[model samples]
Structure formats: C-alpha cells, structure tokens
Target: MYRKSKSNGKATYDLREVVTNIKWSTDLNFSAGELTFDLIQNAHPIIPYTGDIITFRWDHYKIFYGYVFKYEVKEDNTVSVTCYDKSRYLKNQDSIVWQSGTIADRFNNVCKRAGIKHKVVDKPTHKVSAEVCDGKTYFDMVKSAIVKTRTATKHMYYIYCNYDVVELRRAPYKKLKIIIGSKSAMTGFSYAVDINNTANVVKVIQKDTKKSQAKSATAKQDDPKRTSFKSTSAAGKSTEQWGKLQETVNKKNKANHAQMVKQAKDELRKKNRANKELTIDCIGHIDLVAGNAVTIKINDLGKTLKNCPILKAEHNFGTDYNCHLTMKVGAEWLGNS
Candidate 1:
C-alpha cells in the first residue's frame, strides 16, 4: 500500500479497487498478522516494487501493516503479494539477561533492540524475576516472560502487531458488549468440550542442596498452609470422574512452601476442567480480530459461558467479507493463569 521513495515522501496507494482476494489472518498462537492479495499490474500506471510498505485501514483505525515480502507477476499482468506484520521479526534469535522490570518493560527493550515500533496495552505491574537466554528467538523469550508473570502474579497477556507496530496486551484486550447467537449471520458453527488434558492430582517435588530427592508425608494441623512437610495436593472433586490424572512440579529450597502449595492448587484449577471451544463464522467486522472477547448465547450452553476469548480469527475479503474464529468457553479460560 506504500512505497519507499528515494526522496523523503509520504503516501499510500488506494488499493481498494486494484486489489482482489484480500485475506488477513490474526492468531494468538501465531507470531504475526499475515496478509495476501492479488494486485492487477495494469490497473494502475505504476506499481510499487518489493520491500515497499503495505497497509490496510478500516475507517479511523489502521488494521494491518507490513513490507512486501514476495510478489509474483504472471502472464496475465496480475501480481500476488504476501506480507507479514512487524512481529515477524521477533522470529530472529538472540541472547540477553533481563534482570528487572515488568513484562511490559522487557517487551519494550526487545522492540528497541530489534528496531521494531511497538506499543503496550493494559500493563501488568508485577515484576518478573531474572531470566537469562543463551540462545532463543525473541518470540520465545517474550513467551517465557509471560509464563513467569503468570506463575508469579497470575495475570495473562498476549502479543500481536497492527498499525505498523507490535502490541503487547493483557489477554482479551478488546472487549465488545455485542452478543452472537444462533440467529446471527452464521455460515457455520461447532462447539466442542473435551477432557483430554484434565488433571486431578498434582505432586510437588523438592530437591535438597545435596542433590537428593525428597518427599515426606508429614504435616502440622495448626498450620493453615499445610506446607510444613506436604509435597502433594489433590482436588476434592471425585477422582472417579477423572482417575488421578497426575501432574508434577519441581521446586528448590529457595521457594517458600506456601507458594508451592498455592502452585499445586493453581495447577488443579487450570487442568481439571473440560476444555471447550466454539468455532463459528459470520459477516466480518474489522474489530473482530484475535485476542478479543465475544459473548455467546446458545441454547444448550447456559450462563457458564460469557465473554469467551478469541484464539484466532481470519478475515477473508473477496466478493464478500467473512470471518471465522476459534474461541474458548469462558473468561477464566483466558485468565486462568
């Protein structure tokens, strides 16, 4: 959508008519937003070359931006272009030691070093501990910092790129009050619930300074934490429903016992549920991208599900604009860090 002029200039082509089959994909599990479209070479007197900036905007908001990565010209004088947002650069490998500051601070540091423009939304104040990376991709280090924050402060966040800058946001950053139901313009719908990753028993293991394994089954009734000598915690829920799907966590002497106990409880809360996903497609809304929340009101599902988190969304533009999504069951499904 834009070109890098040899002189200082600012402009973008109005590509609405010359471009066709535009597709923009955003996924929480993917590193970047992607776009592909066909450009009619002859429709315009001049066409930008490779490495030119491309962007898509809807109304007042700029939705996607990236440089032209690939382009193919055919006998028909039509060009196929593929682009990816700035987060694509996060795939590059690096090594560093982040000693202090919240996850937001760490992300900003990474962006500065990588020469990528970035912004932050809904910051988490809890500071993450020191982390040293020998060799890891920038994306991997960011994910690692997120996991550390989740373990310590129990807050969740996600990353994406739009409007020419990478954005780090708390999970479900964009919230809409609108509801989607069976009456919506749905082309397809499928909701599934499975217990594939359920767990009811969590065992905590500790190794001594001498490098010996230790597991004791003694505790003091007077202590509320019950962490005096406990190494395992089991959910009160009947194991008959899910027979002792066990998980384990290792800790060092430096970690407090109470923290370990709460860690076990956290594991149980996250793993004991039936993971539910509702996949659907309808007429596209520019705002309906990933890392947002949508309300669902179907007949079979009661009030148990509201504000479901969107895991991925793909908006296809051709004859019509349509979007489909993969969404989780409830707000907790996204926030249960």
Candidate 2:
C-alpha cells in the first residue's frame, strides 16, 4: 500500500479503488490524428485532414476545423483557436483530439470552469525508434514512453498514453483524477485497506493481568534470628527445669515458623497461577493492541469521520505461544496523505 500524510490537518483520504467515468483530453493536428465528430461540422469527426495545412511556430499548437470553439486576439496581432469536445469522449474506442485553443485560452476557460490542469506530454524520439521490448509491440512502446515521461515529470499526479502537452489546459475534473491509459491495465493500481474510523468494530484488547488481592503476610517464622529467654542464678533443679522448658518452647516455635513459611510459599504459587495464560482453538478474537500510528491510502478517508491509524500488525508463531493485541480508545490517529 502507498502511504502519505494527510494534506488537511483535520482528516486524510485513502483511495480504495481506481474510480472511472472521468473526462480527459489531448492535442493532435487533423493530419496525423482525427478530431472528435460533431454532427454540425462537415468534416468527419474521426478523420484527419490530409491537405496543405498552416503551421504556427509558437509554444502551443492550435487548429481550426470548421468552427472556432474559442478565440483570443493578443496585442501582438496573433489570433488563436480553441477546440472543445462538444460530445462525450469514450475510452480506447474513440481516438479524438480535444482542445481549448492555446495554453492561455485553455487556462482562462478552465479558470472559468473551476477545474484543475492535466497535461499529456510527447514521447522522446529514441524511445519510439524501435519496437516494444519483451513482448511489447511498437504501439505498446509508444504508449509506455508517453506514460513514463509524464510520470517522471514533477506535479504529474496522473498520466495517459499518446498525449502531448503543448501547453497548459484546464483539467478535465475539479478534483484529481489519475487515469492509467488503457494500455497499462496490467499494472492497474496499488491497493490498501482503509482502516480509518474502524475503531468501533476493531477494539484493542489489553493484555494486562489483574493484580491479586490478599492480606500482606510476613514470613516471620522463617527468620532465623529470634528472642529466647534464659534462666540464671536459680536453684539447680529449677534451673534444669527451666532449661528444659526453654528448649521445648524453642522447638514449638521453630515448627510453627516452618508451617508459616510453607503457607507463604503456597500463597505465592497460587497468585502466579492466577496470572497464567494458555492458547486454545475455537476462541474469539480480541481487540488489537493500542499503537502509535498506521499507513494507508489517501482516498479512504470518508466524509463523516476523522483521523485513524493502524495499531499492531498480525503475525504467526509455532502454534504454542502467540502474542495477543489490546487496543485502547484514545485521541486522534495520524497518517500520511
């Protein structure tokens, strides 16, 4: 998937598919290429003019079929012609030359129409010098050269085949439309899933274990150091008895301390067990882990929502131990446009 940051700070758009039904145009003289057919015009719409023609040695090329679609007279005493597509221009099936006169003419017209600018450039001579390479025929090579040339140029959001940019013209649409000329159908488009604003359905599941609760018990019985009572200056019999009594008390205390130590160890084991986890089949999926950001197409941003980023990526392990994901709700997610 191609990734880019959002142009607008508020939201980003991820394109899901290569949408069609857009308009496009090109520059071609009547001799080499055909002009679009207009019923009112006497010339065949798809036929090129073969007679002697007038050539203007200027920055842009213009032609006058039967009528002048647009005209501009500059201070230099040079009049220009602008051709507009009176009818629809179909893809592939029709080879029609679209125009709006000169670059200035098309620009002014497009400004009036509130549209962008798109240009198709001419192919280099060396590229079309030979046939297409690697199963690509001569026509395919020509088409490729045109598309590639346009793509190489800066500010070319889209490119088409057999199109030459003599001068700037009004864009066919108000928004960006990248149409891969029919020739490059094999390499149609690069796709990415639009995960924007999908947090409601794909929640992140936290992997944190809850803390166990129990009274804090000290292992005091396990402590080797303890106070002991001793008797001195007593009657010999009394002293002996006292000594015996002290020994018995010490033994009882040691046993009790040992029992408490064992109990403490057992309680710790139970707490560890509570935190243990296991893998199992036929289990439900949980929310993905919360993350920083994700990459996606620019056109996928819908009109309703805002920023959304990808969390954790999916992975596979040796069937025994697998990492789980936990997604927590948060603020805005950032992405490339």
Candidate 3:
C-alpha cells in the first residue's frame, strides 16, 4: 500500500485506493528521483499541490520523501502529481564555510545550512584541511566533497537520499549476486557500447592564486604519447580517438598536484564506464536500489560481472499492487569495485 504524510506528522493520506499508477525511480548520479503518479479525483480529503510534503510507501518500505512540484487535473477527472526528492531543495541553495573535517562533517554542515536532516551511513575516512562553499549550490558542493573523500582503501564515496534523510555511503562491492536467464526472475536485458562519448584522455588545469600561475596535468587511457588500437577481423583498426578536458579553479592553498592528477584519472575512468552501459528488468526486487552491489551472470554472454553497482533503478506499481523493476548496472571505476 502507498501512503502520503506531512513531514511534520500533522496528517496522513492513504493513496492506495485512489492511486491509478506510480513511477518511482532513483539514480546514483542524481540526487533525487523524478516521481510521478496518477490518482482518481473523487473528493479526496487532501488535495496535493506544489510544496506539499509527501512520503511514498510501497508495502512496508518508505520509498520516497519528496515535495510536490506540480499537479494537473485531467479531463477524465484524474489528478496527476509530480514530485522531487529532498535533494531538490539543496540543488540551488548555497552553504556556509566548512573547514578542517572529515567528509561526513562537511556533508552534515551543508545539510544544516540547508535546514535538512541527514544521516551518514558509512563515513568517509579522508579528511580535508580546509573547505569552503562559496558561490556553489549545496548539491554541487556535496558532489565535489564526495569526489575528494576516499575510503581507507582509496575508493571514492557516493551520496543518495534515503526517504527524508541524506546518506553518505561507499559504493557497492560484491555483496549480492543475481543470475539472468529464462527461468530466473530476470525479464529482459540489453547493453550498449558507445565510443562516441568515450574519452581516452583528460586534462585538468588548476589555477594557483598567490603564485599567479596555473598547474596542469594530463591523464591518458594507456600511454600519454602512444595511440593504441584494436584489431577487428572485418576491417582494419582505425585511429579515431576522443578526449575530454576539464578545468577547475582551486582557491585552496593546500591543493596538491598528486591529488589533482588522481582526480583527473578518476574522472576519466568514470566516463569510460559510463560509455559501456547495461540495463536489465526483473520482477520487483524491493531489496534492490541504487548503490547496491550485485554480481550479474548472463548465460548468453557467458560471463559474470562481479561487484557491479546499480546506476539507476525504476520501481513501477500498478492498480492491483503489482510491481516490477528496471535497473541500469555497470562498473564505476571510481568506486574501485
């Protein structure tokens, strides 16, 4: 059953009876899910509108806590409501300065400035000497913090919203395993490899304030000078390469060149993994969500993908409480999985 309630616990509404359809989805790359649903408008006690706080619960699990951003009434007397997760509030809001603390501390500080409650499930061990959130939204600041923070093993962290709370956690390793085949719960599967978006090299430039100079570093896929090609039986190898250049102004005096190089390489790896994507569908797995580690075995491909992270997850519910899931899965090199 699905339920909507006020954030302050003042009132509650049971939407199961009137709900026609629901689409709840979340992503590791995005802070919030774009949630939408349709309801039969037959004198419902509460009218959902913009800025109203609503919590979506599927079965016993509270799936989403979001604020309604849009609503419309159809000619057929049905109401459609669109909502976004709490991170929507953080997207455009600025934060105060935070200095000399762990990534969790910085994250909590930003949440406090945004007036949102947050919880750190897995704290990142990396510590920063000084950090400032000037001229940047809370969302953008947190994303940068996640990229800077690393685990004891040097793996990057991930951020996501768990209902009303914001969670900072590490990427999934080989924790859960799922097999895809005709007899399994898997319903569909597909993959795509696009070289168009692949970047073999990344050039990161960081400006130095006091010195009035800019220090730059370049990270390449294989060899910085050599161009590598693969052989295909059908045709001779071609040398059409791709490259991405990123520049950031580092105001901090303590910024290290080695850290900047690592960051550049991490960014390149992320682009490479995103280029090779796989999507799969299955019966509703309530236990599955973004950031969960699962090993996927495909009989047709005759290969097992270990420590694959779920990039995106979509949960659909129908009139009769039927549920299904569609998820995008792939390797995220920054996670070191």
Candidate 4:
C-alpha cells in the first residue's frame, strides 16, 4: 500500500487493489533503491505529479520514502511512477578538500553538507589522512574515505538507506534468518566459479620525486638520486595451483615501507580469491536488502556458510510474492572444482 501527500491537500492511497506491477530492487554496488509501480486511475481519482511525496509500505512495514522523480501517463488512464530514496542526491557533483578525519567523521560532514539525514551505525576505527575531491560526486568522497579506512584498519563498512536517512553501517547489518532446503522456501539454485580475476601476486610501489625537498632517512637508504619502494604479497601455494598472475600499482606520493607492504597484502587478499556466486529463488523477505547476511547449509556437501553476503536482491510483489537474490560468496576460488 502507498500514501500520496501534497501541499494543497492530503490523500491516502491503498495500492493493494489499485496498483499493479509493483517491484523493488537494490544492489550493493549501486547508489539507489528504486520503486516502480503502475497505478490504475479509473479505480482511483488521483494522479501523482512530479516532486510529490510517496510513502510506500508493505504489510504495514515502511519500506521506502521518496519523491516522484518521474511519472508517465498511459493511454489507458494509468500512471507509472518511479521513485528513489535519499541516496538519489549522491549523484550531484561537488568540490571538497576534506582532511584529517575518520570515515565516520567525513560521512557525517558530507551528509550534513548535502542536506542528507544520516546515521553512523558501525564506525570504522581508522582515521583518514587527507583527501581532495575535484568535480567528484558525493558517493566518490564516501568511497575514498572507505578505501583509506580499509587499507589502514582492515575493516569493510557498508552503506545503505534507512527510509529517507542514509546509513553508514558495517557488514551483517541484517540477517536473512531463513534456512535453505527442500523443506524450506529454497526452490532451486545455481553456482559458478571463475579465476579470470585471480591474482596470487600483488606488488605496490611508492615513488617520491620532489627534487626540491630533502629526503628522509628511509629515502636516503634507497638510490640517492630518487626515493622508491616496492612491496609484494605472493601466495606461493595459490601461485602453484593457478599460474603466476601478477599485478602492480604505482602511487605518486610517498608511503613508508610498512604502509606499502600493508597495501600490497590488502590487494592480494582481494584479488587472490576466486569469484564464486550463487543465484537463489525463494519466498520474499521484505527486510532482506543488499549488504545483509544469510546462512546456507548444504546437507549433501556437509557445508554451511554463516556470513554469506547478499549482493543483489529483487523483490517482486506482482502475481506472486517472491524474490530472486544473487549472493557473492567470498569463499576462496576452488580452482575448477
């Protein structure tokens, strides 16, 4: 069901009977959670205009609150509306010179500057040294802070929309809390694994080329002409299993030997893993969005994954209440097994 609100007057709309073709989807890699629905006009004498407020609910649970950014009139007197949560504003570009703050701190500052209501659920324990944004979107700023935090503290944070408020949270914010089997809602499943992106060896090199400034003691240890450092993370076992695939990253400024090593290890940790994915079909869970956790137990294989991440969730409220979820499992690539 949904309610439409405007300045001139207030009106309530029960979409249970009047609206058809209702669907909502969200992805962890995307910035927006969308709502698409077609409203039957003959059943109701109401037409939602652009910029109108849409308060959508499912079974009395507030699912989304957004503005009507688009609307189309059909020849059959039907209105199709598309709305997005507060993350829509993240698309705007801005120039910000942010420095010396934690990820939570920068998130608060960005939300405040963008007029976005936000809350920090799980604060990262690392502070950002500095970041300069020139003609970058707000989401890009958030990502910069996240990258710095992850590199320094080895923690990954997830961001999502809670109603109209942007929430900066950690992983496993919400659990699927359902079993998957023949006896449960689990209907069918398919799995695949690929090593196209696998990289057992990662190297990070730092270069300092400012000739005007004096070099530090560490820089003096290297070639006197210039300062350079290289760090590598190579999984000897994985390299033998798969071929030797290496990649290099270069930075303009300077980082200590330890920092460079940490960065290389981080890169190896991510690239070394194979991409394993599971596509599942089951009954719809209204609260199950991207970045949530779901547990799966395969009795035949005698395997159970406790913190499987939900990468994409598409909930359909059309003919039957069902959802299709794509889970990106971080389980190490098992070669061709």
Candidate 5:
C-alpha cells in the first residue's frame, strides 16, 4: 500500500504551482445569519480541495489584522474550522466550497469541531444605523475624537484609520480625518485626533467648538478688535494684534533659521579643526597685557615690537600704576606715571 507523504516541498503536491498564483478577493459578507464568502459562479470561488485554506478576518477595517484557522474535510465533503467569533451566524456558519452550502450549515460544522456553541435564530438581525465618512479630512474632529474617546473608553485603543474617508448614511460612523499642511489655505484649525471611538470625538468637537467660540466671544467683548481681528485675519486682513502674532511667528522662524545656520557653521569648524591637514593662520596681532605674563617664541624675541603692538609691557608697578597694559586688541591701560 502506498500513501502520499505530506511535504511543504513542491514534489509532494502536484497543483502547488496552480494554488500559489490564484487571485483572491478581500471582500467578505458578514450578515447576522452567517458570515460567508460571496461566490460568483467560480469567478472567485473557493477551490474545493485539501491544503486549500481561507483566513477568517474579523476587523478588516482596523490595524489588528485577522488570523488563519486550519480546516479538514469530513466524509460529507463539508469541513470544519475554528475561529474566535462566538455568534449564532458565526457559530457554525463558516464554510468552504462544499460544492453547495449556505451560512447556517457552514456555521454548524465549524462550530461543532471548534467547540463553539451558538443559538440558532430564525431570522437575521436588524442592521445597525451607522455611517462611513470617507476622504473628508476631519483634522480637528479626529483629534477631538481621540481625546474624548481616550478619556471615556478604557478598552478601545486609538489607531490612525487611514482610508478614503467614505461618509455613509448607515453603517460604521465614519469621520473624514485629513491632514492639512501648515501651508494649506484651509479655513479651520488643524488637529491630530485619536481614532479610538471617532463618533464620540466628533461629538466632543461639536461640544468643544461651541465652548471655544463662546469663550472667544466673551473675550472679544472686553476687546472689540479681537473679534474683528480674527474674522479679518482669515482673509489676510491685518490688525495690530494680528501683526504682532505674525511678527512673533516670523521672528521665531528667523531665529530658528539663524540657529540652524550657526549650528552648521560650528559643526563645519569642528570638523575642519579635527582634520590634520587643515591649518589656521592667525593674521591679527596679539597684544600683551600688563600684570599678565607673556610667552613669546624664542624666534619672535626681537621682531619689531611696532607691528606686534605691545599689549602689556609692564606690570606690578604698584607705585604709579596698577598695571600698564598696551595692546592692538584693546585700548592702552596706563595710570599716571
């Protein structure tokens, strides 16, 4: 009797080359009755054979990608796979191409082997009213969502949901979060929001904006120009305060630029100094200061003191002067003789 040995190498499986190149669709149907793969007349149907596996993904929309569960076929041509989901539909509904199968039967076989118990419902659960907000950059809205959700929910972690923000009337509530650059000519202030529970974040923004506007308004009453300044500032209109703010921003930018330049110069100087090949020629005269002892190279002993310019020739003349100092670097320092 000969038996086929299981091997990951190509020789063991005849159709290994065939299975590797198959095109698979990401879309899956998750209805209350049962979550099932939508089959379209073998266009993207599951190949009915051993060693063929399909992974069950739970939150395809989030960062935490789903896992894969192994499946083995029984005599009935139907197979069972284990998953973390515990739902009436999910309980026994997950199936492969049994030649023909529905969500319920698929759910049962998988659930049985996986030891997942679930209730069988006669009808599908009603769809929840949710929305998907796509592509609309919800800068402040998303940021506010993060803060509020972070404050409110403990288990819900914020992940930057990067997708074409699609706004749907019913489904998951989608807040269109976009990142507008500082140079972007957008009217509103930009913010980085947490995406833990975005709906709550939007609500918080709505709540917070009102408070901000109210506070702004109340403050404007004390300074009438403040309101006018803000309104006009959007259109590039300049008020004294606005000018001051602009000046501050400009000055900060200029200071940053200057500091960067200075740092670069210092770095270059240090690098040059470290190079053994590099030499620094001192062109300027060094003057002697009185009361400060001087060390001259023996060769420089009698060089014309005229060009060298005495910085300090005498010191400890306690009788007439504190210390006579002369230098090209500084003014002459000599008291009454």
Candidate 6:
C-alpha cells in the first residue's frame, strides 16, 4: 500500500487500489532512493504532482517515503510519477560557511539550510576544525564532511534517508538475523567478480588553498614552506594480477594529509569490495535496505556468506498484489559489531 500527499500538507490519499506498478531503488553511496510508480486514473480524486509526498508500505512495514518530482500522463489514462527520498532535497545547490564541529553537527547544519527533515543516529567522535561549502551542492558538501569526520580507527558512517527522515548512522557492527538462500525468501541469486573497474591503487591529491598557505606561513616563519599537495594510495586484491590499477582523485579544497590518505584508502576499499558482488532477487523484504547487513547461504556455492552489506536494492510492485526486490550485496570491512 502507498500514501500520497502534498509536500508539507496533512491531507493524504491511499493508493493501494490505484497503484499499477512501482520501481524503487536505494544506494548507500547516493543516500536516497530513485523511486517511481505508475497509477491508473479512475474515479480517484487525487492527482500526483511535483513536490508531493509519497509513502509506500508492504502490509504493516513501511517500505519507502519520498517526494514526487516528476509525473507524466500516459495515453492509456494512466499517470507515472518519479520521486526521490528525502535526501533528494540535498541536491539543491547552496553556499555556506561551517564552523568546526562533529560530523553530526555539520550534517544537521546542511539539513537546516536545505529544509530537509533528518535525524542523526550516530554522532562522529572526532571534530573538524573548519569547512566551507562555496556554491557546492548540499550532497557534495555533506559527503565531504562525513569523509573528513570519520575516526582514526577507520570508523565507517552511512548517510541515508529512512522513511521521511535523513539519517546519519554508524555502520552496523552486527549482521542482521535474516538469511537469503534457495530455501529462504530469496527467489533468485547471481554473482559476478569483475576486474574491469577494480582499482588496486587510489591516489588522492588535495590542493592547498590560500587560507592553508597563510596558516602555514603564520605557524612556521623559519621553515616558510607551504603544503601545496598531498597524495595517498592503497593496494587491493587484484594489485598483483592487474599490475596495480591506479585511480586518482583531485581535490580543490584543503584537508588534513592523514584524512586525505584515509579517504583514498576508503575509496579503494569500496572499489575492491564491488569487484566481487552478488545480486539476490526475492519477494519484497520490507525491512531490507541499503546499508543493512544480512547473511546469505547458497547450496551450490558450498559456503555461507555472512555479514554482507546491501549496496543497493530495487523494489517492484505490480498487479495481483505481488511485490518483489533485487538487492545488491557485498562485503564491507569497517569492522565487526
């Protein structure tokens, strides 16, 4: 079942009977689901439009909550609407200066400016000195803040939209109790190990800004040297086989050298993890979402996959009250619960 309403209004309309089809997907990296649905135009009085709110549910479980941004009236008298989770609001470009604080504070500030409703589930223990978002999109700025605020022990953070609220939470230390297999709820499963996009080495180059140079000059008059750039890399499993495939990132802003190095390592880790991936298709698991940890068992594979993080999920609901999902699962090594 699903509900639709104006962006910030109280009125809502149930859409279960009129719902024709749905395609909803969410990814940890993007922090929002690309949700779309089609509804038959009948005697219903409600009409979906831009900036409308949508909430999807499967039985008693809330599946998705988002805002419709696009709609099309089909020739068959049906309407197709495209929506994105609350994080979609962060895509709007803005400029702002942020004072030093924790990752939670930075994210909350961005949400405040963007008018995005949010909740910080996990707060970063570390603190950042200062950051500036000069005409950058809120998404980019918040992502950078998250990268910079990660702890030295390599604590991982996940930012995503849950229902109507934006969430910034620590990566799960404990795996979910649910299992996926032929005998389980999973209906189909496939895996791929592609080295084409795998990168063994990641090099990050952070350029020095005028402010950094000034600070350097003030801190050391005798040395009188400016840290113009910093670079770091990490080797992956395919490093030996592929002879070290290198990926380089150029950052225009100034950041701590150690932090930049960690960022590069994190990027490399993600790439390595993506190289070996499994796609599990099953009937809709209402509670399953990106950033969730779940176990998988395949009889033919002869081994159980444990503590796998969902990288993406695609949900489909069609006629006959049937709903299904295809989830992309992979390994994440931030540490164990």
Q: What is the C-alpha RMSD of each candidate to the true structure, in Å?
A: 7.3, 33.3, 8.9, 6.1, 32.7, 7.2
Question: Scored by Cα lDDT, where does model 4 land?
Answer: 0.74
TM-score of candidate 6 versus the correct structure, residues matched by position = 0.73
Question: In TM-score terms, which candidate is top?
Answer: 4
Q: Write the per-residue lDDT of candidate 6 for residues 1-337, one digit (tens) a residue.
A: 4555555475778788878678878776744677887888765435687877788876676767888788988777788889888888788888878787777887888788888889988777787767778988887777776666554446667677877788888766346798877787777778766677767788888655344333443444333354466577667777666677788887436657777777788778766644566777776765566767678788877858886777666777654332233334453422221
For candidate 4, write residues 274-314 as lDDT tens digits.
78887778788886678787886655556576767787788
Per-residue lDDT tens digits of candidate 5, residues 158-263? 1111121111111111211221122331122211222121111000000111222343433333334332211101112222322321110111132344454443
Instruction: Estimate the TM-score of every prediction.
Output: 0.81, 0.15, 0.71, 0.82, 0.15, 0.73
Q: Rate the local accuracy (lDDT) of all candidates.
A: 0.74, 0.23, 0.63, 0.74, 0.23, 0.70
In model 2, which runs have C-alpha deviations exceeding 4 angstroms? 1-142, 146-301, 304-337
Inter-residue clash pairs, candidate 6: 173-337
Model 6 RMSD in angstroms? 7.2
Per residue, candidate 2 scores C-alpha lDDT tens digits across 1-337 of 0112223342322211221111112221111112221111123221112221212111132321121233344444333333232111111121213232222332223223322232423222222122214533222222333333333332111121122121221111122122112132111222233322221111111122333354357653322333333321111233232232111111223334445444333332222111111111111111111122211122322211111222222212222312222211122111110
lDDT of 1 by residue, 117-197 (tens): 999877889887788987888887788888778767667787888678798988768777777766675667788877777
* Ranked by lDDT, top first: 1, 4, 6, 3, 2, 5
TM-score-wise, the better of 2 and 6 is 6
Distance from true location, Cα of 127 in model 4, Å: 0.7
Q: Candidate 5 at 327: error in angstroms?
A: 70
Return the lDDT, model 3, position 171.
70
Candidate 4 TM-score to native: 0.82
